[model samples]
Each structure stands twice: as structure tokens, then as C-alpha cells.
Target: MTDHLILRPSGEFAGPVDEHTLVLGIETSCDETAAALVLGGYDVASSVVSTQVDIHAQYGGVVPEIASRAHLDMLNPIIARAIVEAGVPDSRIDAIACTIGPGLIGALLVGVSAAKSLALAWDVPFIGVHHHEAHLYAAFLEDPTLEFPLVVLLVSGGHTMLIEMQDHGRYKLLGRTIDDAAGEAFDKVARFLGLGYPGGPAIDREAVHGNPEAIHFPRAMMHEGLDVSFSGLKTSVMNHVRKHPDVSSEDVAASFQAAVVDVLVTKARRAAQQVGAKGLVLAGGVAANSLLREQFLDACVVDGIHGFLPSREMCTDNAAMIAAAGWHRLRSDGPTSLDCGAFPNLKIPGLT
Candidate 1:
């Protein structure tokens, strides 16, 4: 356990708790159990994330049961750590927010249950957040100057979508993956090439030395407006590896990334043009890939569209992003009741 204890006043605290709302945000959407305390406005007081990567690493991916069990074990400690680090007593927390959907049902329940419990115990408001929407709002935490009417490319292990954001609450679904998500393709291809788990970063690292043009790979749906597909591409990679069993892994990684990047950038460029968006923001765990970042920036430069990405550490699962997302929810509606249940297949509120 990480120590973050802080002393506080005994009777009356210095300032009004309502004047400065501190929100406790919890996220257990997948394999990470995260908690963060964010002050009213934009300050992140404390963030704690307990990962189940090692436990899931051997399985090549997250096991829903294992993830839920791990979250059950870490949820309380993670929340306690956030509160301690924030130097705020439980009474100071104005609201509780949690990732409520678009993830494993069991995993989502852990965070939702914890948030509901805290809200009930403290008589505070409870707010539910969508995981992918939270990813888009992550930009707010890193870049306060970021405004709306932008295009968001949300790429993750389970999702690949293009969203046009008109404002804080309004969204237009431009396109989405027709098959496997980009991150899922990366993981599957990496496994095929004998690379280990959590494949995006590993593939990106290997692609640096290998030539992306080494093998000719198909860029799917390049002419099909903004919709994308990676299943055909993943199958192509599998077939290539089977035909050439002795091919170099580095070359395979490069070729795979090249194909993915080509499709992603192509679609993003089209989305920017179609929607006339001024900015292009990349969100989700796969956005951490250095190659994707580089390729998207290059595409944005050619298209004269600004590209934005969160810090690499924020790309994966974390509560800081969730807290930032919760800020929007709290600002709009205040809080929620304890009966808010976790939703497994939730999409972006408006996009669905």
C-alpha cells in the first residue's frame, strides 16, 4: 500500500466544503482499479491506480473474473490513498463519480459499487461516467485551452471510433471500426509475431528500427469515407506469418503498425475534412503508441488540422482522466443517487 496520510482539523475545517467541491473519482473499467481526488475547477489533488497487468500478462489479456476480483481487493485502499493524499476528510468530498460503462460488467460493478457506497455513506452525490467519453475529456486535464467543436479519434483495445464534438455534451458519431478495434489488432498481431502482452507500445518500439515499407500491407477502407476495418488486415498478417514462418519479428511489427497507421490517419484526415473540424484529438490507450502519434501529427500537418494527445501516462487507464470527465458531469447536473447501476455496453451518451 502507498502511504498518503495527512493530518486535519478536529472540529471545524478552515473553509466551506461546498465552496470548494472535491470529487472522488473511481475507474475500474478494465484491468485497472483507479481513484482520484479532484478539487472544484481543474485541480487534481490526488490520483491512485492499482494495476492487474502482471496477473493478466500471462493470460495475454485481461480476464474478467480476475480483473473484478483484483478490483475488489484494491478499491478500498485506492480510495483511502486518494483521500489521504488530497488531505481531505471524507466529509470534504462533495461528490463521487465512477466509470459506469463500456467495459466488463464485473469490472464496472467494482468501481460503481465503491462509488455508490461512498456516496451513500457520506451522503454525497454520485455521478456515472462513460469510459470512452472520459477519454475524450482527458484532453481537458492536460490542455485547459482545448475547446469544443473538435474531432476525436477514440482508439482502444475494444473500441475504435471517430466522434465530432460540437460542445461538452453533444457528439456526432462519424465512423467506427467495422471489425476488430485498432488496439485489439495490435495485440493480436503482436502475439502472432511472438511479441508479449499489451502490444501497442512494444510494437511501436520495434517499428522504430524496422522499415515500415518492408512488406506491402493493405490499408483497409481507405476509400470508404471515414469508417475503418482491421479484421481483414489482421487476417492478412496471420496469413503472411503462416506463409513465411521465419520472417523477422521487427519487420512484422513495422508492417502491422504501418497498415494500422495508414488506415487510422486516412480516416482521421477524412473526418477532419468532412466535419470541418479545427482540431483533431486522439484519445484511448492505443494513442500512447509513438508511431501513431507521429503519423497522426504528420497527417494533421498536411491537412492543416491541429492534433492533440494526452501525456503518455494518461493514455492508459487512470483516474485523473475520469475525474476530469466527472467535472463536466458535476458542473451540469450536480450529482446522482446511489441506485445508479453499472452499464457494460454503454457508448458515448449522444453517439449511441
Candidate 2:
């Protein structure tokens, strides 16, 4: 269990092997128990996500203990299903990968433990993937031909940061949230607005029918470099609701979303321009936001920079992205040590 395997001279493991590589990726980072089969980094044979959204919806957020237990219960079956759907024999898997950090501790352990065990059983290399880094890799899975010099904005419930990608596995963080991340702000505000759990989708749907200019919510740090702030905006929304009890919820939602999108897009574009990036990318869970996606693309057009975003499935937490990142890691850095431990607060490389 203490041995670290290298994939450089590997026959079937991830690398520039004679044939394509197959990786089984497991992810139990939060409320989703996911497993996937990815071929040659970009081709997804099958991906299965058993979401606990309904179970966590009652609480308006994920409970780490509950998420961990659910992962333990569902992971085996999910992995099995991915293999079955991919029509690949268990022994044919070239490598095993799993998200190892920057998530709920217990939730991360399930995936890590499973991945380690599978690698041992299958006698293949194990790759421990960083959660946020994998999100950036999701864009590559959709289009493997993406060029370097990319300005990537990673926005999610737990993190918000802008990174400059010089190349695969090379990143330099430009800025990040000083307080609450964009997703956390969305969840808190959505709860205050009685929009139910998983606030991003709730607020997005409501905003569709409402006027984005109805409230003119504050856009924090619009001119303050690439770092973002949303706590003030969240508080403002709550205070507004208290004062104007009769205010339209749809209007509130629209106004709040507009504030977020404006800040993210403006900052992202600025970063891209500063770095002279060839492409701009939106990643992480919150990138799935409709307004963010639409506005981001529109801004990219205006800025004359190439834009990249993965499908909604890849935007949120998933094992497929983990596998895709894993393949790249194995190819470039070889394999991870078996003694590697799960890190709940694993920051991406070049974290500011």
C-alpha cells in the first residue's frame, strides 16, 4: 500500500501508450456519488451520477455526514453501472482516479478509499485528482484542441478564483473571493428569498421572467482587480427583502443574478486582457448558470477572445472530469503514491 507506481513505462496505464487508456473515476466530493469511464482523456464511455439533491433539498444544503453515508451506500453500484454501461470488463480499466481534496472530508474519503481499493484490486495505477483543477479540465474534455494561455474563472459553492493556465497542469491564481464565494452567496440569498435548496438553479429560473434592472443590486469589486466579493451583495438582498416585504421575488432573483454575472464577466474579461490569453473559460458548478453562460459568451464575443464551456453535466461535480484530469496527470507526472491522503481543503496549484 505504500508503493507509488509510475505510468511512464506502463503498458495499459495512463500515458502515451501504444493504445488508448481507460480510466475509472470516482467522485463523492459532496452530495453526488458519481463514477465514470473516460477513454483517452476526451472520450467518455459512460458517466453515472447518483445525486442526493432530493435528500439534501429538505435542509437547503448538503450535510456532510449524510452525503458521506449516501456515497458509501451508492458508490459501489454507481461504479458497477459505469463499467456495465461502458461495456468494459473490470480488468480492462487502465487506471483508477478519484477526487481527493477541496471538499467535505467524509465525502472525499469515500471516493478516495474506493479508488485506492480498486487500483489495488485491478493492479492498475491510482491517480488522486484535485477537485477544482478537475473542473478546469472539464472544458478540455469537451474540446481537446483548446490552446494554452487561458484565463479561467472557477466559480462554485465553495470557491471563486481566476487562474491563468500557461499549459496543461500549469496554473497561476490571479484572484479569489475574500469572503463568501458566488455559489454560497447564491444559496444564502435564495434561501432568504424562499427559493428552496440549490439556489443557483432556483434564482436562475426565477430571473428569466423578471427584469434584471429592477433592483440594480451592487456589483462588489467590479474594479478591484480579479478578486470578487459577494457577501455584501447577499446581505443587501436580505435587507432589501426585509424592508420591502412586498417586493417581487422574481425581481429580487433577477437583480441578484445580474449583479453576480456582471462582476464575474467583467473581472474575467479583464484578466483575459491582462494575460493576453488566447481563450477564456468559465468552470466549476456556478458556471452552469444560464445568465452567466450567456453573458459570458456575449462578453467573449465583444472582447474578441475564444470562449470555452462544457456541457451542464460537466460543469457541475462529476467523475468524468476527474478521469480526464487524471489521465493528463498520469501522462505528465506519472502516478500518485498509494499513501496519499484525502485533503478537504486542497487548494489548486498556484493558489493566491
TM-score to native of every candidate shown: 0.92, 0.94
Candidate 2's residue-wise lDDT over 156-216, tens digit each? 9999999999988789998889999999999999899888989999999999999989998
Candidate 1 lDDT, 31-71, residue by residue in tens: 99999987763678998888898899899999999999999
Native-vs-model 2 lDDT?
A: 0.88
Question: Relative to the unseen true structure, what is the C-alpha lDDT of residue 242 in candidate 2, on a scale of 0 to 100?
Answer: 92
Among all windows of 10 consecutive residues in model 1, the one with the lowest summed lDDT is: 1-10
lDDT of 1 at 126: 74
Candidate lDDT scores, in order, read 0.82, 0.88
